[model samples]
Target: MEIDKVKDPATVKLHSQVEMGSMELKSILGYDDQGLVAAPEKKSSDEAPLKVLYSSGSGSFNRKVMRNTVVHSIRTVVFSSRLNLLMPFGPLAILVQTLTGHHGWVFLLSLLGIIPLAERLGYATEQLACYTGPTVGGLLNATFGNATELIISIYALRNGMIRVVQQSLLGSILSNMLLVLGCAFFAGGLVFSKRPQVFNKPTAAVNSGLLLMAVMGLLLPALLHTTHTELHFGKSALALSRFTSCIMLVAYASYLFFQLKSQRSLYVPVDEGEEIHSDASDDDEEVPEISKWESIIWLTILTAWISILSEYLVNAIEGASVALNIPVAFISVILLPIVGNAAEHAGAVMFAMKDKLDITLGVAIGSSTQISMFGIPFCVMVGWIMGVPMDLNFQLFETATLFITVLVVAFMLQEGTSNYFKGIMLILCYIIVAASFFVHIDPTAIQDKPPETKE
Candidate 1:
């Protein structure tokens, strides 16, 4: 005891506890001292300083990521094309609307503004599609590609511009089937002058059949009205139109399921000649410029802006018709569709030039099918909910135009081959349609006038 230095039991216990605590702390801090004489450890660096540095670095990192996202989204969407030059027209249109009563100028400016926006909208959708995979991607393209027209239709519907909605939707189908597809075929043929361009025949046939079905959906209503053979007079025609719309919507849903799920192979892009290697290489090289979330944000912003401009555009239609000395029929049936479809038109032609005829057909014929099968019926349902009397009765002239157009397109696509001659014919057919609309007066316009009293 005298040699070892005896201690009190309580003091020894406390000392042991302190040593145990020190060892645990050292272990947690990754320190070790063994098999040597231990030197006094320098004071551990202050955790406060390290923590402050880490926090600041993390904050800066977050900021950098956010900045990159913004820059990338802007560069991809706003600066991707020369079409962006038209973007200023959006703000200018608003200014013109606010400052003056020049509805024609406002309409023109709004039309120009929407061109870039529509193209960018499609671009954003395509970027998003890269994330969604091909099946959902095709649906996204169809939906957003028609978004401009849909927005305009909604605005028109809200204003009780029923005829405008009908004609505009009809025009969208016509423009896609004729003008966009024609340009695509024409451009592709010129580029591949030595051979004919080919697309997926089954896909084209399916789209053609769907277009014909849509024609029937529209035709029956017009015929019912014109023949005065409705079971309940005026009320019966409206009822039939609503019922038919619901059925058409169901058919479109099934078609989408077929294309996306059951028979997806039918829609795969058909590459021929030298396109196979080039397309494969291009697919490998293709990378999305914007992230998925960024694509979504841009789509929302673009759609909202489109809705705003579409409001202005719809409001200006009647005024612009009077001020510009253009017939309302031509404006609704020809001009509006062309402007709304600028994105689809450009994309179809570009793909065709690359000899990707399958994609071209999807952009053109698929769009026509969507408008007829989905867009028109969806509009009818929307109107029903809104207590608006939107219907499939496109009048005799419009319905007949649609019917013949479908037949012509169906016949042309039956061969599953396209050449510049076929393209020229389609283009000529569209020109004739445009000319007819230019001179044609809307029956609804005349009907809206007060009947004259006998002098």
Candidate 2:
């Protein structure tokens, strides 16, 4: 329909910001067409009156386009604002972490520690959380993660700083064995009365077996070297130990290989409502992959910051006790790792809340692996660079605590089932370990031992 009004030379942009709806864009005319441009206001075609009162200029189609444009722009701005906060700090913190090794203590503060390690494990699992059909990727992501963490840890172990490596190893193990698994059992059991959901048989079986092996692997060296670790292994023993670790390593490799195969061949039907995390779901959106370059850059920076600040951390502790009046033991054992791990820990808990059991498990385990691998090795590498031989290793108690924790966790998660009872067991185990740290418990004195117990 054509209008009789003359064209107005002045057309000012007038934007209507609507609440709970898309904004509308209109052009205000100066003189010739001052009133609203009407497109033959028609009564409802079917006489429905209360819905849309009237239709105006160019019908509903033109208004929709304008409305859509405004809405998209508004949403873009809103989303970008949140991303803006992490844009600088997240990457920058990671970069600062990778470069300086102010000693292995950097592992705690440095976000780059795991980010780069995750990228380096590229031949294996990926960074992105897939959100699509089939559980192929999701299954692989979960099961194969152990291999990736092991690869990273091996690199860290070989680099040295036996203590730092050991400490980080202990840290990672405890976090997973106690914290992650415990949370899963606790949360899952608490939420529902039925037994916690289990994964496929083959995958669960392999995972349980590998976890048991890991427990054995960590314990072997400690037990063997308890007498004289300084007596570095001869060629034969070294070869044998390496060969053993290698065989254990091969088991993990087998697990990964089998997982990949299963990913292709197997098609176990998931719960109709079973949300395949990282495999497209109704609840959560997909995880954007971290870029390789960003991973590399941040890892370097994070290393540097951590290394540099460690001396400060050690130095500051002296004054911290004086100022804060906190005990040295509490500050050393609890506060430091907690502070350094704040980010990663949050990441783990977040995964749990999302019901990404695999990720929550992986992060806790990967962290220990990172601490053992990158954290320890980085410290050793830095020490070598500086020509300073640092005595960076954990105490016997720490290692024992970690070993015991993993042992118990392996037993609990062995059946691929978790519940409140299992969670309680984990928590109880953690408590026992903590108490052992403070009090003395000599098993040799009591000749009583439970089955599957850590000797």
The C-alpha TM-scores of every prediction are 0.82, 0.49
User: What local lDDT does model 1 show for residue 428?
Assistant: 97
Residues 1-455 of candidate 2 have per-residue lDDT tens digits of 12322322222112222411231222221112334333333232333443333443445766787688656543432243332343243344345446653322333333333333222222122233343222333433332333322333333344442333344345444655576556656765676445464533444344545555655554555455555543554333333344455465456556546645646344343343255343556433444334334333433443444343333444344344344444334334444444344334444444444444455445554444434433333444444455433222243565566556656655665575555787778767766654553343223221122221432
Q: Pick the candidate with the highest lDDT.
A: 1
Q: Using TM-score, give the best candidate's number.
A: 1
Residue ranges of candidate 1 with Cα displaced over 4 Å: 1-56, 131-135, 273-280, 283-285, 446-455
How high a TM-score does candidate 1 get?
Answer: 0.82
In order, candidate lDDTs are 0.82, 0.43
What's the CA RMSD for each of the models? Answer: 9.7, 16.1
Q: Which stretches of candidate 2 lie over 4 Å from their true place?
A: 1-127, 131-161, 191-195, 200-202, 227-251, 262-348, 354-400, 438-455
Worst-scoring 10-residue span by lDDT in model 1: 446-455
Model 1 lDDT, full chain set: 0.82
